[model samples]
Target: MNMTSYEEMFDEYVKSSAAYCASLFEATEYFFKANAALEATIVSTNTAKTSTIHSIQEYFETCKISLIKTIDLLRTFQEIHTTIPGEQVEVDFAQQYFYIKKTLSCVEQIIQLFSTVRDDKNLQQQIWDNDDFTTYFTTSADSISQAIIWQCNFAKRANLDESI
Candidate 1:
């Protein structure tokens, strides 16, 4: 490819990849915000009982936003990878892709689980009924962070310039 063409491809890849990273960060922030809202509701007094349901509602909103962001990022990642082609598909790139795939799977499952209980009269109650909710949520969140870290490490090692 000509130098300008290569530079254009590089710029496209970098922009898309950076967008994916930004979406990931936004999702992570929403996840934490949801967690904090839930926790705050748990510690509130009887007078603030309404806050319980409100907090749960907030959590749902944030979770939905995060899920949407993740889906968008995943699609963008795929397009960037496919369009870039050739040399960009290095070993580290493949590894990072796998990590992202795993993270996407986990996020999908979380969204599915939440969807089933989303319309329940008492979301907090449904969540409380699930003994594994905390463990599942914490583990999934940690896995996502690990996957993002793995992707960053791969990019750095490969000198891909998409690190962020």
Candidate 2:
């Protein structure tokens, strides 16, 4: 897809993910409040309150699993193609540069949104603050760097540095 379309998709994905997490948190807060009220009025029903908390925990776990899946889906942004008709396939540096920059911005935003939802300071202190963040940033940066090097070599070999 073109850069504009890719960006639109990325924004939509991030917004949807953030909204989902917000909804989950809101629901969790509501459940906790409800459980608290139950405990206040029905002090003898300890087992039921414990079960309510367990259910809330289970719900959050499921939401986290879903968030991870959507984050993994962001890998599609890096799968751009540069096909050639013959055997000699050259890199499209311009296309790579544009999309790589967009991907980097999207990843940064993703990291910000990812960190806001979680309370663990330890995880927030890590690189990108999410399980896939390190790999995503490193892989994208490496790909962009390689593309730059390859583009420079290609321009030098063709003696078309000015054109590039």
Q: Which residue pairs of candidate 1 clash? A: none
Clashing pairs in 2: none
Candidate 2, residues 25-108: lDDT per residue as tens digits? 443344334334423423333343333334433433443343343333323322322221222234354564453344345344
Give the per-residue lDDT digits (tens) of candidate 1, residues 96-161: 455445545554555556555644245567777886575567676776677568656756855855
Provide the overall lDDT of each model, using Cα atoms, as 2-decimal numbers.
0.62, 0.41
Residue-level error in angstroms, candidate 2, position 153? 2.1
The top-ranked prediction according to TM-score is 1
Q: In model 1, state the lDDT of residue 156.
A: 80
TM-score of each: 0.63, 0.28
